[model samples]
Structures are given as structure tokens and as C-alpha cells.
Target: METIVPDSEGRGLLARLPGRVRDLVQLARLDRPIGAWLLFWPGAWAIALAGRAIARWDLILWFGLGAVAMRGAGCVYNDIVDRDLDRRVARTAARPLASGRLSLKMAWGWLLTLSLVGLIVLLQLERTAQIMALASIAPVAAYPFMKRITWWPQAWLGIVFSWAALVGWPAVTGTVSAPALWLYAGSILWVIGYDTIYALQDIEDDALAGVKSSARALGDHARGGVAGFYLGATLLWGIALWQVRPEPLALAGLLPMAAHLLWQVAGLRREDPADALARFRSNRFAGLLMFLACFVVGTAT
Candidate 1:
């Protein structure tokens, strides 16, 4: 069941740009920008949700920088860890590490550079937010190995990816509340649902590699599991809103987002990897819709 992703000749032609341009693309994962948005949106949403005034573009700008840098660092680390397995997988086999375009030393150097940029962004955050950001390092470091040892690396990914919620609340209000915790919980479930879809693209390769994932664990029922997770996410989000404003109307804003999740579940085609990737990337829109719901709920009520 080795899935061979045919090379997009168009992409290969585009890669023929100057070598420097190619290296930069590989370094920043420009070829895969979804990770950056996935990382940034929760933090941005949390900031908007906690704001006493309209969400400021300046805060979004800073979080954008942090997201790009941190996501680059995370990708570099993942490549380092998965280099061997990556070489065995068709979709990842042409990556910098797997293709031998980048040595370990060069990869480490790239990782450090990205991390320094992320550090600079961290310095701009409030003290509480800065500390919260620092607390994520260990979990981030450990995430690359979780798939080897557990059947639920998607859950670990949830924790790692949703950390911006913790930092965002502290950035806006200097401390987290019960409502904020609920938001964070909902964010984690949302990550799990989407990342599990993502993991499905690699399930056969992962199973052969002796790696475990929710996709492989859930097998043919993955759609049901994903739906359940999305439903739980919507429920937690509604509960968080209720905790903040305790009004039915306060939760109404989330219904559209809930419907969107339902659409994702109903539209998903489990056996199609391309369909899975599309559904997974579509979560960016889901994140935006939820962010708007939170912003309206927090700002108006």
C-alpha cells in the first residue's frame, strides 16, 4: 500500500528557479504553507476572542511572524527525525533531507536560524505569554517521536499545535480563565480531527514503517472517529462561549462553524488520500469561521 505521489512536472519546472530560491522554499516549507496558517490561526483567534476592543492588525502581524518561524523550525525538526522514513515515502522522498539536498548540519543550521527568528517574536509578547510560549518547547521536541510509540500521535499533535491558545489569552489578559481553558480544549480537539485526516494520507506507509496513527488505528471507521472529534470540538466551543456569556444567543454564532464541520465529515472520502489532504487543508477555513464566531461573541457580549 505504498502510495506514490506522482511528481508534478509543473512544480519540478518551478523548482528550476535559482538554487537559492529552491533552498529558501525548502527551508520555509513554502511548498507547504498550510502548517503555518494552522499554527497561527488559533493564537490569532484567541487574541481576538480575548480583546476588549477590535482585534488589532499589529498583533496579527507579530503572530504571523512567529508562526512562520516556529513552523519552519518544527518542519526542520520533523525532517531531521523522519529523514529515513521520508526517503521511503513517495510524497516526502524528494524533500531536502530525503533527497540529500540538505545535510544534517545544514538542516540544524536552518533550524537554529528559524528558532532565533521565533525567539525574537517571543520577546515582543507580554511576560505571561512569553513564558507560556517557552513552556511548549519540550512537547514540541517530543512530538516527532510520538508516532513511533503511540497509536494517537494525532492527539500529541493537537497539544503541540493548539498551544497558541494558551499564549494568546495571556498576551491579551495576562492570565487564563476557565473559559479560555475550554477554548484551548476545543482547539485541541479541532487539531486532532484535522491532523488525523492528514495522517490518513500516510496510513499505509506508516503501517509498513511500524508507525502508528489514529488513521491506522481507526481503520475503516476513521470518518466516524473524525466526526466524533469535530462534534466534541463544536460542543466544547459552545460550552466555552456559554461560560463566558451564558446566553443561548452567545452560542448561536458557532452554529455555522458547527455546520461546516458537519459538511467536512459528510463530504470526506476516506479511501482517497487527495480527498483527505483537501479536507485537512480546508480546516483553515474552519479555523477562520470559528475565529469570527469567537470574535463576535467576545466583542459583542
Candidate 2:
């Protein structure tokens, strides 16, 4: 019987499940929902920014569901691909596949099951949105190998995770526009910033395993690197807001989120794994702040 891993977020609930079920749940990362929330926000921002959120509320629901399923599938695939490397990282070593609690066949079955749920969500979108969503497959397939090839794998993750903005805009408006593009671009920066913080938790292990990440690349300058990425995200999001509503007050929508990102960067304890994990998790709230900004600017008269 496999016990809960150290990084699991829902240990109480996970503990009640049968051993195999618990392993599957952990394999899909269902125990930790921060990733799903992070994955969902870009699409939510896009829908709200497109000014059709209230009317197209269904898209939000669908995207939210899709985020959970697809993020899970992505995690399963990443685990399958990195199972060897995962064993080399203490934080990741106990993951189902890496720890030998789950077999490759079981992991593949879970991946397909999660992907089936994703397919259901994808079928709910309009043609344009569906096409846009399908286009993400190549990037998604390429992401697990990124750390092996580049220090900027977080950038590839940014690309993969921020793809919902492309689909959401088209889902709402039946066409992609400048606002969506800017939102996607800004979201990529945001992902890189937060994910760098996430990578801080595994810096030493990643180095020992020969894995590269922005956190390792930044070294002592990681805080500044995160600050730079956050700053760029804010500027791009401001530009996106301006594109939607050119009035001065429109840019004010970003103030709260900007302040939040600043707080994260200003107080970040780069060397503490706990602080790094806390800062990374706080992006869930940061994401909501940006969504509110997008909502206000997008829905304003």
C-alpha cells in the first residue's frame, strides 16, 4: 500500500481512499489543485476580457473543467516521461510512478481517462475555439522534454499553459483579437515568474539530476529575475487592458494585481524552500486579482 507523499495537499481526503485509488489520484495531481487553478485562470481572463463572460458563462465552466482534466493529463504524461528523473529528486521521488507504487500501464490508463474528460470539454467549444485548442497539442507534447534541452523550460510551460487565452477569446467572440494576444503574452511571463519560484524547491536536486530551470539559471539573482518577469507581465496586461478600453481608468484595473505581484517579489525568501513554495502558491490569488482586473475593464461601459 502506498502512503501519501510529502507534497500532497489533501492528505486527509487522500488517506481515506484505497491504496490504488490514492496512487491514481496522486498520479493525476488531484491532491494538489493549485496547478488546475493556475491553468484555468488564463482562459477565464480571456473570456472576461472578451466581454462575453456573463453571457458565455458556460465557457468558464467548461474551461474550468478542462483545466482540471487536462492539467491532470499533462501531469501524468510528465510523470511518465520524467519518472527516471523524478526518482533523483527528493521532492518528486515519492510520486506514484517514480516510487513504483503505480505501473506504467496504470499511469497510461489514467492519462487516457483524464484525456477523455478533456476531450469532452473540448467538444463543447465552437469550431474556432476547438481548432485553437487542438493547436495546443504539439506544444503540450513537447513540454515534458523541455528541461532536458533548455534552461527556460518554464517558458515552454508558459506557452503550453497560457494557450487557453487563445481558445477562450475565440469561444466568446468567434474570433481571436489583440486583447487575447496580449493577455496570452502577459500570461506567459506570469507563468515563467511563478514557475521559477516553484523550481526553487528543487534547485539542488535538479542540478544533481542534470535538469535545468530558470531558478537554477538565475542563481542568486532569482528574485530579480522573478521581479523582471512580473514587471513585464504587468506592463503587458496593462497594454491588454488599454487595447480593450483606451481610457486612463482602464489601466487602473491592473493596480491590485500589480501590487500583489510586487508583494510576492518583495517578500520572497529565495533560499527557503518553504517560502518559495508559499510564494508560488500565492499566485492562485494573484491569478484571481488579474481576472478581476480583466473583468472590470472588459465589462465596463
Candidate 3:
């Protein structure tokens, strides 16, 4: 059987670009911008929710740069750690590190360069947001090892990816509150749900390589399990909103996001890898929809 290349992700441009440029693109995940957007949206939502209009644009811009830099750093770090495992996985086997397109030392150098860019972005934030951003370092450093120890690594990833909520609130309000905390919690559950769907794409490869993930843990019941996670995420987000504002209208904003989650879950197909990836990528839309809802709820008079 022939493998099909995704339209958005093929070896076309990378094959044409010079070595250094292509390597950098692979390290930065330029071919895959969804990860950066997923990391950025929650921070944007938190800023909008705070109604700090004066600095909102600045915060969003910095967080956007930070997301791209940090997400690149993460991919580099993951590639370094998973070099061996990645070689065994079909989809990831062609990754720069796994395919021998880039060496380990060069990858580390690239990682440091991206981290420096991330540091520059961090310096642009307020003292509190800077500190909040710094606090994520330990979690980010520790994430590559989570899969080796737990099937619920997706849970830990949620906690790490959603740290932007922590950063954004402090950047905007200069302090943490119950509302911001609830938003952070809700975002974690949302990450876990969506990332679990992503893991479904690699269940077979993961199992063969002795890897642990939510999809493999759930096995034949993966679709139903993902649905349950998405349902719980919606409920958690609703709880977060109620805690933050306690207004009936505030809860109404959650309805669309909840409905979207339901749609993703209902349409999920555990047996089809392509379908799983499509569903996973579609969460970018889910993130956007939720951010808009948060913005409306937070900024509305």
C-alpha cells in the first residue's frame, strides 16, 4: 500500500530549500503552525477576558511570538529526546532528527537560538507575567519524559500548554484571581481532550514501540473515551466560566464551544488515522471559537 502525503505537509518545499533553511523550518515547525496557534489562543483569551484594552494588543503580540518560539523549542527538545522512538514511528520517522537530516548537536544549538528568542519575548512582558512564563520552564523541560512514565501524559501536556492562561492574566491584571485560575484549569482539560485525539493517530506505532499514550490505554474504546474527555472538558469550561462571572449570560458563551466539542467527539473515528489527525487539527477552530466566546463574555458591558 502507498502512503498518502497530507496536502499541508509534504516534502515539496523542504526538499527544495537549502540545508540550513530547511533544517530551521523543521525545527521551528513552520510546516505545522497549528501547535503554535493552539498555545497562543488561550493567552489571547485571557487578555480579552481581563478587558485590559490598552495593553491587550501588546500582550497578544508578545504571546504570539512567545508561542512560536517556545513551540519550536519544544519540538526541538522532543525531537532530541524522542530521536530513537521517533525513528520507529511511521509518521514521525521522517522528522529531521529521526531521518538524519539534522544532527543532535546542531539541534541543541537551534533549540538554544529559539529559546533566546523566547527570552526576548519574555523580557517584553510585565514582571509578574515574566515570572509566570519562567515558571513553565520546569514543566516544559520535564514534558518529553512524561510519555515514558505515564499514559496520562496528555494531562501533563494540558497543564504545560495552558500555562499561558497564567501568564496572560498576570500580564493584564498584574495579579491572579479565581477567574483566571478557573480559566487555566478549564484550558488544561481542553488540551487533554484534544491531544488525546491526536494520540489516536499513533496508537499502533506507539504500541509497537512500547510507548504509552491515552489512545493506547483506551484501545478499542478510544473513540468513546475521547468523547467522554471532550464532554468533561466542556463541563469544566462551563464551571470555570460560572466561577469567574456567575452570570447566566456568561454561561451562554460556553454553549457553542460545548456544541463544537460534541461534534468533534461524535464525528471521531478511532480506526482511521487520517480522520483522527483531521479531527485533531480542527481543534484550532475549536480554540478560536472558545476564545471569541471568552472575549465576548469578558468584554461585554
After the best TM-score superposition of candidate 1, give how far the Cα of residue 142 lies from its true spot, in angstroms: 0.2
Q: Judge candidate 3 at residue 1 and give its lDDT.
A: 44
**Predicted structure with the largest lDDT when compared to the true one:** 2
Candidate 3 positional error at 158, Å: 0.7
Q: lDDT of each structure?
A: 0.83, 0.92, 0.83
- Model 1, range 19-62, lDDT digits (tens) per residue? 65576567568666789999998887787777542656677788
Clashing pairs in 1: none
Model 3's TM-score against the true structure: 0.94
lDDT of 1: 0.83
Model 3, span 119-174: residue lDDT tens: 99998888999898999999998998999999889988999999998999888889
Can you give the lDDT of residue 100 in candidate 2?
Answer: 95
Clashes of each: 0, 0, 0
- Better candidate by lDDT, 1 or 2: 2
Which regions of candidate 2 fall more than 4 Å away from where they truly are? Answer: 1-5
